[model samples]
Target: MTDRFAAFRALHHGDRPLLLPNAWDHASAAALAARGHPAIGTTSLGVAAAAGLPDGEAATRAETLHLARRLRGLPALLTVDVEAGFSDEPAEVAALAAELAGLGVVGINIEDGRPDGSLAPPALTAAAVAAVKDTTPEIFVNARTDAWWLGVADPLGQALERARLYRAAGADGIFAPGVSDSDTIGVLVAGLDAPLNVLHRPGGPTVAELGRLGVARISTGSLLFRAALGAALATADALRAADPAPGAAYPEPPSYVEVQRLSAPPGAG
Candidate 1:
């Protein structure tokens, strides 16, 4: 609840949407910060996959905390995706939020989607949002309702209803992913009192288009991680096939020395 928190909160109100790139590990986070992203988010899928766990099952609390500890030293604001807060209990979720806030985290994404393909009850989600705000008022809480993501009937109606409850319970922003249409995004931006965040799709709409539709924040959730994985597999396949120009499809990676420098401790060589 200081400059970092305020700065992160302020990003949502910028003239353009705050383009937040989600990272899986320290290297990705550090690399994005070095590339001039003022804020970075943790992709729940990426984190769980990296730890050999499943995402949205509340299974990666320890892994998330460990990564947060490692990322505390990065030169950027941090927002963690605590998938459903790793627990349905309000106090438990709030405690996790407080812990992340203490570790220099500025924000968190708490989604209502469950592992079993159901959305949490609006009351449960609201209680968690309220508890987190009570525990750490300064941390930005981007409450996520996965109505569209889970493909529920009346997705927009369900999302708006749940978002209202979360906002009333003290959520700072409302994120409804999987709704990529411009008209729908505009309705969300116009309907909600809090900032509306959307997920970035490669061919759906550009960042500028989202901004034009009044999106406050745009997140690349798991896109970078999946891309990196695909690139690695493609490179391996090319080499196995003895094909020429195997590296042409991917961007050039950082030099070995550059990576070593990035991984070094503050005073270490």
Candidate 2:
């Protein structure tokens, strides 16, 4: 078997940031793999919302693990968004990471945000990173801090502080979502030691612009799934507007995922 953990780790160190698309399930993952995404991630929001479960809570451990199992045989490398490892306990989170690694997952994104709209103690995320690294030793731990998203003052400072802790604890990357400006993002890329991951917001900085800022990873978290939902509704609206549901060859834009896939993250090099 390939050392996919190492392979996925290397993707972050490339000349360009790895543009990772988040998938909801096997079909999505497989479709992404078929389209040549070398690495793919699972969106916690997509997984939970698809199953009628709440996201950012400890409600989707079973669903996440089941999705991991189904995607184990997928062609592309996979990382899962565990949403704070699905537990406040470090041991449980570490156990979950180990199980995912055993299921052929290459990486995990463990955030520090709580479901109740506040950030967890940074120590919890740090300890989880330490424990996960101790157990698996190879899984790419993308330690996520919700400082910006949680509306904390000095988000960059707090994110950097928490990132330092997680890196020291064995995180391979630092993900700071909701920091949108170029200057702030560049500052983060400069301050952090590990690869910096930014969530791709629609109409925000483009991939090339972000790569120029020295980011190493870009994640389309829940966007593809949400876009699919919108697309389904749009298709229905079109059918409702026409008599007899007339269909035409609509090949104008690429598939939803393909649009992102084509942009591909640019290289800082």
Candidate 3:
């Protein structure tokens, strides 16, 4: 546990911003791991939508746990996205964190966004972070503040306050999603004691730019999942229009035999 925790900690450095690619399930995670990504994060939207549940509504707790358990067996480090811990109660959120730790999860992203586009109280979120650290001491608690995403009051002030509270409560990192400005990101990184995690914005700053701005981690955060959804729609439309040149081409997928081998009985050839 110490080694795994150390590995996760080492990934967040001043020189390199950890580009964490978010995955939806086993296949996506395994494929990313196969491609040599050091770590993988599960997207809450992906998990909830895949299970026919709405994201940020505390409706996919079981599905998120199950996905985390499946992802923990893979080669890369696994970080589960527990949407606001799936509950308002701090102890319940801690229990969820403990369950994730028991499943060998290395990190967790707990957001402060409500179902109605509001932010959770900072005190409640602080208590949740404290409880998780007390219960699962080794698991990295990335306290996320969606001030910008939810359009909360005074984005910077709100995020900084929540981040301070969370850090005091033993959060390992502070994630301010939907913040892409270099100056703001630099300020946040300079002000916070814990590592700063920013969402990867397309056409925004590059990883090098983020690293220069002192961002420790950059997450895709459902962008890939959403892009996949869009690609699927485009592919279907192109095929219907009998124009194969309108969409991106994909490589030949694995056969049944190879997929079956992935789940072959132990010691069977």
Candidate 4:
């Protein structure tokens, strides 16, 4: 295996967009890595909900750190989604980034989405990005914009402005979630100086389409984790409703014992 951090960074600029699949736990991440994913990212929603914490509320800092420590030993490069950097203070966010870097994390996705479904002040987010980069210059900072996700009418303008500020603040990439239309995607791909990371939705353009439009990265941000949850529920419902029994065996679901072995935390096996 290559140096995961350096290899992960190099994967960003290849001819095709890096189809980054976000995992919620060590098993999900390791399973994906076993299937040949070069790098793995933690989804904030998955991390928070698994711990019974609310997402986007900055309530998962400890959970996030613990997950990072567990995931650092995985076979693939690891990137963590620190929702809104977990605070408004730049120094606090930077400190969190430094800790992640020290734990062998190579990349981070910090969003501007707030707990109230709005965006944080662009300046504040940019400051946080700069602080993180300053503290860990080698760590990949992916500045995320939630303009379209929050129904901001001027999404293009907001994304462009935030992208500019974040790039100036040393962000290595820009993630514009909820942006899948060809026109807007094209404009953002052309405008941003950094690599553009878009969320891949079911009805959205294919990977080739995004690559044709010049997108550099495609993140399945919470989509896979949520889909996995939905799939499990659907299987259970089908089995419950079936007269005899539905064919929803669900592959035996790997076993609790196997899960324990895969995710033995940092110590205490």
Best-performing candidate as measured by TM-score: 1
Count clashes in each candidate, considering only residues at least 3 apart in sequence or on different chains. 0, 0, 0, 0
Of 2 and 3, the candidate ranking higher by TM-score:
3
TM-score of each: 0.98, 0.90, 0.93, 0.92
Per-residue C-alpha lDDT of model 4 across residues 88-187, encoded as one tens digit per residue = 9999999999999999999999999887888888999999999998888888999998998899879899989989998999999999989989999999
lDDT of 3 by residue, 24-129 (tens): 9877787787689988999999988888888889999889888887777677888889988988888999999999888888999988889988888888889999
Q: Residue 57 deviation, candidate 4, in Å?
A: 0.6
Tell me the deviation in Å of residue 143 in model 2: 0.4
Report every candidate's CA lDDT: 0.93, 0.88, 0.87, 0.88
Off by over 4 Å in 1: 267-269
Better of 1 and 2 by TM-score: 1
Worst 10 residues of 3 by lDDT: 259-268
How good is model 2 by TM-score? 0.90
lDDT of 2 by residue, 1-269 (tens): 25787789899999888999999987778778878999999999999999999998889999999999988876789999999888878888899999998899989999999878888888888999999999888899999999999998888889999999999999999999898899999999988899999999988899999999999999999999998887767677777887363345222445787655433433312
Q: Score residue 231 of candidate 3 by CA lDDT.
A: 76
